[model samples]
Target: MQLPILAYGHDILRKQCDEIDPSYPGLDKLIDNMWETMYGANGCGLAAPQVNVPVRLFVVDSKSTHDRMDEVIREDHFVREDTGIVETFINANILDESDDAWIDEEGCLSIPALTERVKRPWSITIEYFNRQFEKQTKTFYGTTARMIQHEYDHTEGVLYLDYLKPLTRKLLHGKLEKIAKGQIKAKYPMQFVK
Candidate 1:
């Protein structure tokens, strides 16, 4: 079943998610539904908080252009196809010790009408658990890396706008107010027509 996505200003979206229970009832199914939601919404990533499920879980399915292999590989190392797609991360723990961070434009599923360039790490090595409760380590860089960090922020009750400068925030204040009112919607509407 597709879960109702929490819009901007929803208290749940600002609340930190709880650690997921591997054996919890319907946990796997919930993740599946979230994947559907994310794909249906054309989102690069989706967090439990966005789905109103306050659990430490999120789904990241690589799009054709935002492919993980392209971002994870450099001149030498490579990644296998099976390692991407339908990615599920539970109890995600990110190591933000990297001194290398950059700025880029980002959008959120909940806050749809606007996009902003925010400062974020260009690379990350995150440790998380799959739906089967198996531990996994995934490294990301470039756009994919920025995305991982973006969704990971949701798990911690952080929004992309929070990283914006005060001047930028003021410049977009009107649109942000509309978002806070849930009056704005994504220009490209998302539906499960396929």
Candidate 2:
């Protein structure tokens, strides 16, 4: 099932998400729905808050991005050689971030049709539970890390727009307002706040 992604103005986007354990009701189903919803929206990542669920969970599939990378670049940067790996992160915490920062344009499912360049660490070490509730710690780099950081921010009640300069944000105010008002058309289904 594909869930309706909540738009930006929704309060749930700004609220910190709660952690869920294995016994949480419909854990498997909810994760499946999120994947369907995210892929439906052509998004590389999606957080629980984007679906109006205040839980520390997000799914990512960076295979397309990975496949497009130059072979040399791929071998040099990515920790995994496999392209199109789907990962589910639950109750994730960033244990460390590299001081090296890079700027990349990012888009969000909740803030449809808007993309912004934000600065973030090039690598991160995170600890989280998988879909099966097994604990794991892993470090990610390059594009994968960038995508993870974006979704991780969602679980922390932060948006990529928040990282923009005040002037940049002001410039986008009109478009954002339109999005909040449900005045813009989105390719995927969305639920705007009334």
Candidate 3:
């Protein structure tokens, strides 16, 4: 089932998410629903907070981005030789970040009609539990790493806009306000601030 993604200005989007163990109820179903919601929204990733759940869980499917490189212009510019990963991350933590960085335009399901150029490390090492509760630590590079960092920020109550310059953010203030006022329309179901 696809869930309604919480839009910008939702208080939950600013709160840190809590870690959940395997004992958490409906873990499997929630993960499934998140995937469905993400695909429906045409997003590469979706975090728990985006769905109004304050949990340290997110799903990233860089594979889809990789697959679209043929038709999408410059889509593979930052993607590495690796095909990319499609996996779940629960209670995830970024352990290390490479010195190299790259800039790219990023958009979020929660923040519709907006895309910002953001700079992020080219590679990262993260540790997290998979959906089956198995502990795993892996390093990712290129587009996949950027995708992970974006979703990881949601777990820490941070948004991509926060990385923008003050002037840029100020310029976008009105646009962000419009989204907060529920004046934005998205292809996917969204719950706005009310």
Local distance difference test values of all predictions, in order: 0.72, 0.90, 0.93
lDDT of 2 at 16: 94
Per-model TM values vs. the true structure: 0.82, 0.93, 0.95
Error in Å for residue 154 of model 1: 0.6
As for lDDT, the candidate ahead, 2 or 3, is 3
Compare the candidates by lDDT and give the number of the best one.
Answer: 3
For candidate 1, the 10 contiguous residues with the lowest summed lDDT are 74-83
Q: Candidate 3 on 117-193: residue-level lDDT in tens?
A: 99999899999999889999999888899999999999999999999999999999999989988898899899989
Relative to the unseen true structure, what is the C-alpha lDDT of residue 38 in candidate 3, on a scale of 0 to 100?
Answer: 97
- lDDT per residue for candidate 2 within 1-194, as digits (tens), equals 99999998999999999998889999899999999999899889999999989999999887877877798877654666446457999999999999998887798988988898889998999999998889999888878888888999999999999999999999999999899989986999999878
lDDT leaderboard ranking: 3, 2, 1
Which candidate number has the best TM-score? 3
lDDT of 1 at 117: 76
lDDT of 1 by residue, 110-131 (tens): 8886788787765678899987
**How displaced is residue 14 in candidate 1, in Å?**
1.3
lDDT-superior candidate, 1 or 2? 2
lDDT of 1 at 172: 84
